[model samples]
Target: MNAGAINETDICESGSQAPAATQFHDDAPAVAWLREAGLRPTRQRVSLAELLFDKGDRHVTAEILHSEVLEAGVGLSLATVYNTLNQFTRAGLLRRIGPTGSRSFFDTNTSVHPHFYLIGEDTLIDVPEPLVLEQMPNALPGHEIARLDIIIHICRKSRDA
Candidate 1:
């Protein structure tokens, strides 16, 4: 497997650019999830989970993910892809980011922390973990913050004016 490539199995083709199909291994979470979640281990879901787990510490847009699946010739529909993503998100396996620019990205890591977005470059950087630990939000009289998420958007300065 290439440095960033996740081993995914597909009925599509053998020569896709992503990587080769990988068999079940002790460490692959896909295999474990199948066993733990009572899932039947369908080829599509397994392939998706493996990619999610193996991609470690990376954010990916669904389009990019679908392209990879299609490149592998998995023949999965976009709706199915979205459905599976929503299922995983509900299962606490993924974090769904709302509209960021024109694209939405999925963060595989569940551990909470702030994020910085460089709008000009469309780059996302995870804020250092320590910052989250030190700051606590003040609560209102009637309601408290159920979740604290910090996303900072950034942009580069243009030379004009």
Candidate 2:
């Protein structure tokens, strides 16, 4: 498979695209979803989409997605998972959150909002609603801020309380 290709199962005669079938299967909605998002729906892409969309909006890291794919009986490498994720993000189907430490979490919800990052646990959850900034900050001399991300760090409550 090419570095940009996700699945080797189904490929067109040109050796570059997935077959565009009109029929919709259990996974067909995922294919359609990808297409609507301007992305080719390959086997791997559809499978990953199903997992990512199965439980509604949720955040997942590439490692977590890789494990889920393996548990789902899908044969996919970690690298492929990473590539597919980046593709999906670029296509605007998902959102990518930083290397807080070493890895990033792919948020299924692409809308702009704040998130709660659990320290030590390395987990993230939506903040229920978008955060409200009291005052916006001014960019430096030649730079401009494109967006803002408010991540709140949380920890377990004291056992006594």
Candidate 3:
């Protein structure tokens, strides 16, 4: 995996066993953003929001975020992180992408776009340009296509040509 890439599936599945308790300062911008999204700006929510949005656009899993929160000296449970992320997703503040049933990634950029998932590196990268599909498959009788999610998986080449 690349530097800073989180490949620990165990941690992702099971949140931190124990987290230290620490005080968190209020983040004005995060509070405002949360309120605008119709979500209450609780201390935990504000703290997580600040960390998640401080960096531009990026992808993260619950475990990755939980680890970051701990590193920041914040006292938050894995469950809390999961709940907050789900709330953000429901409010359209984030987009959830599940490459497989067992793993999911939260994208800070809500805009519609494709992504490239590095197989061994366990990282997700933006595709840069929009993809144009030449044809669309017909939806079932009364069903309609809500949206399209395309993720291209890439891996390293072998040592031998």
User: Per-residue lDDT of 40-129 in model 3, one digit per residue for the tens?
Assistant: 777888889999999999999999999999999999999999988987887778888887678889999876678999889888889977
Clashes of 2: 0
Highest-scoring model, lDDT? 3
Best by TM-score: 3
Pairs with steric clashes in candidate 2: none
Q: Point out the worst 10-residue segment of candidate 1 by lDDT.
A: 1-10
Error of 1 at 48 (Å): 0.7
User: What are the TM-scores, per candidate, against the unseen true structure?
Assistant: 0.67, 0.76, 0.80
Ranking by lDDT: 3, 2, 1
| Candidate number with the higher lDDT (1 or 3) | 3
lDDT by residue (8-110, candidate 1, tens digit) is 2211222212222444545566878854643445566687777667766867667777887888788888776776665565555666665375766777775
Q: Superposing every Cα of model 1 onto the true structure, what RMSD results? A: 11.8
Q: After superposition, which runs of candidate 2 have C-alpha atoms over 4 Å from their true positions?
A: 1-27, 157-161
lDDT (C-alpha) at residue 20 in model 1 = 26
